[model samples]
Target: MSRTTATIDPAELKAAGTARQTDSSAPNADRPRRRFNWGKVFAWAVMIALLIITVFPFYWMLRTSLTSNSALYANDMSLLPTDFDLGGFARVFGLQSPEEAIAQGGSGASIDFWRYLLNSVVVATAITVCQVFFSAMAAYAFSRLHWRGRDFVFSLFLLSLMVPLIYTLLPNFLLIRDLGLIDTLLGIMLPSLFMTPFAIFFLRQFFMNVPTEIEEAALIDGAGKIRIFFRLIIPMTVGPITTVAILTYMNAWNDYLWPLMVSYTDDSRVLTVALGNFTEQTPQTGPDWAGLMAATLVAALPMLLLFLFFARRIVNSIGFSGIK
Candidate 1:
C-alpha cells in the first residue's frame, strides 16, 4: 500500500551483501583441510615394498657374511646375526691359513682374493676407458662428420645390437684363441676395447644433441675436429660419458660366461670367476656358504659404491637423452 516509493541506502544494501558473503565463506575457511590422499598412500606403500624386496637380498647376504657357519645352518633363521664373526671374511681373504681354517672347521681352500680383485679392477677400468674413448670418436664421426655411406654403415652397427651376445661368443673365442690371448686378461678386455654398438649409439644420441653452432664457431676460429671434440664436446657431455663408463665398467666386472670360457687359472681369472671357484670343495666338506657370501659382498662392494656415487648422473643423463 506504499504507493509512495521509499528510498533505500545503497551503502546499507552493499553492506548486507558483503556480510552474507563473509558468513557463507567463513565455514569453508575454518573447515579442516584434507591431509591424506589414498592414491598417494597406496603408491608410497608399493614403493616401500619394492625397495625392501630389492634390498633384502643384499641385507641377507651381509647378515650371512657376518654370521658364523653354525648360526647359518641353525634350524631357525635369524634376520640379524646374533654374533658378529669375521672368520668368513678372514677365510675369504686368506688371512686364515688352510690349517687354521681346517681347525676352525671352515673352508680350507686358498683363493687369491686380492689377485682376482685386482684383475677385475684393471680389466674393467681398461675396458671402460677404451670403450668410452673409441665410442665417442665413432659417435662424433656419425653425428658431426659428413661422409658417404654413413647411414648405411651406422645401420650395420644398429643391426649388431639386435644380435644376441651369446651368438658371437664362439667366433670371438676362436679369434682370441688364434691370437694366443686365451688365459689372458688382455683377451678378456679385447672384445670390448674397440667400440660397442650400444656405446656408440648412446654417445651418438647425446653428441647429436650437442649444439652444432658451438662446433661451427670453434671451426671458424681454426680449431681442428680433434681439438673441438676433446675440448668442447667432451666437456659438455661428461654426464653421458660417465654413464657409459659406469655401464661399461659394470658389464666388464660382472661378466661371467666369457671370462669363464677364457680364464682357467687364477692369474687371468676375474672376481666373478674366482668367486665361483671359491665355492668348490673337495669330497669331504660342503660348499662354504658363509665364506662365499663374504666374498660376494666384497666383490659387489665396488660396483655398489660406483652406483651410489654416479646414480644421479646416470639418471640425469638418461632423462636428458629422452628430452632430446
Candidate 2:
C-alpha cells in the first residue's frame, strides 16, 4: 500500500452484505383470497340457466298432468296447480261410477280398462325380455367372437340403424299379414320383438369395457362361453343391462302404431291404443280430459319411477358404455 488511504476494509463489505439479507421479488406467501371473479360468476350463472332450460319441458308436462283440465284451459296458465285435485286419479281408478253399478260393455264386466292394462303389461314385458336377451347375446358374440367379416356384419347392422323405421313399415305390414300374425300379439311382436340394431350396438360397447383378463381367467377355469357370460359378465354389467331393460320397457310400453295396426280386439288392445280409441270415439259422452290425463299418467308412471330410481346408475353405465 504505497499511498496509505483510510482503507474501506473487506470486513465492512461483509457487514454490508449481512445488513442486506437477500430480498425476494415474489409476492407474499400468506395473502387472503382475491375478490370474486365476474367471469367465473357468469359461467356458473350460464350453467344454471342451461340446466333450467333443459328441465323446463319435464316440469311443464308434470304441471299440466297434475292440473285439472278446467284449470289447464283457464285464461292465464299457472306454473303451479291451484285446486290440486285427485279427481283425475279417482276417475282413473273408476270408483265414482257407482250409480247402481252401471255395468260398462255388458256381460256384467267392470269395463275393459284393466283388460287393456293386462294386455299392455303382457306384451311390453314380452318385448322387453326377448329384446334384452337377444340384444345381449348378439352383442356378446360380436364383441368377443372373432370371425371372418365381423366388422362388415357390424357395419351392415349399423346401416340398418341408419335406415328410417318408416321405410320398413310396408314390408313389416306385408310380412305380418302373410304370417297371419296380423291383429295379434305375435304380429305386433313380429316387427321386432326380439331384435334391435340399436340395442345390439348399445350392449356391444358395454361388453367391450369388461377386461379381457377376467374373461380369460374364466376360460382357463374350463368355463364355457354361456357359463362365463352368465357368471362373470352379466353380473358385472348389471347397471348397463338394467339400463337396457328400462329403455326396452319404455319403448315397448309406449308403442302405438304397430299395436294399433295389429291389436283390434278388446282381448289384444294395449293401453296406448285403448287410450287413443278413448280419445277418438266421441260417442254420446264428452271428452274425459281428467280421465285421459290420469290414464296417460298411469301409462307413463312405471318408467318414470324406474328412471328416478336408477338415474345415478343409468348415468354411470352410459358413461362406461363408451357410446359417448
RMSD per candidate (Å) reads 12.4, 15.5
Question: Looking at model 1, which ten-residue stretch has the lowest summed lDDT?
Answer: 30-39
Q: lDDT score, residue 293, model 2? A: 62
Backbone clashes in candidate 1 total: 0
The 0-to-1 C-alpha lDDT of every candidate, in the order given, reads: 0.83, 0.71
Top candidate on TM-score is: 1
lDDT digits (tens) for residues 236-307 of candidate 1: 999788888888899999999999999988889999998776545631555566788898999999989998
Candidate 1 clashing pairs, residues 3+ apart or interchain: none
- CA shift at 106, candidate 1, in angstroms? 2.5
Q: How would you encode candidate 2's per-residue C-alpha lDDT over 225-298 as one tens digit per residue?
A: 88977898789888778888887787888888878877778878888898787645532334545456666778
RMSD of 2: 15.5
Clashing pairs in 2: none
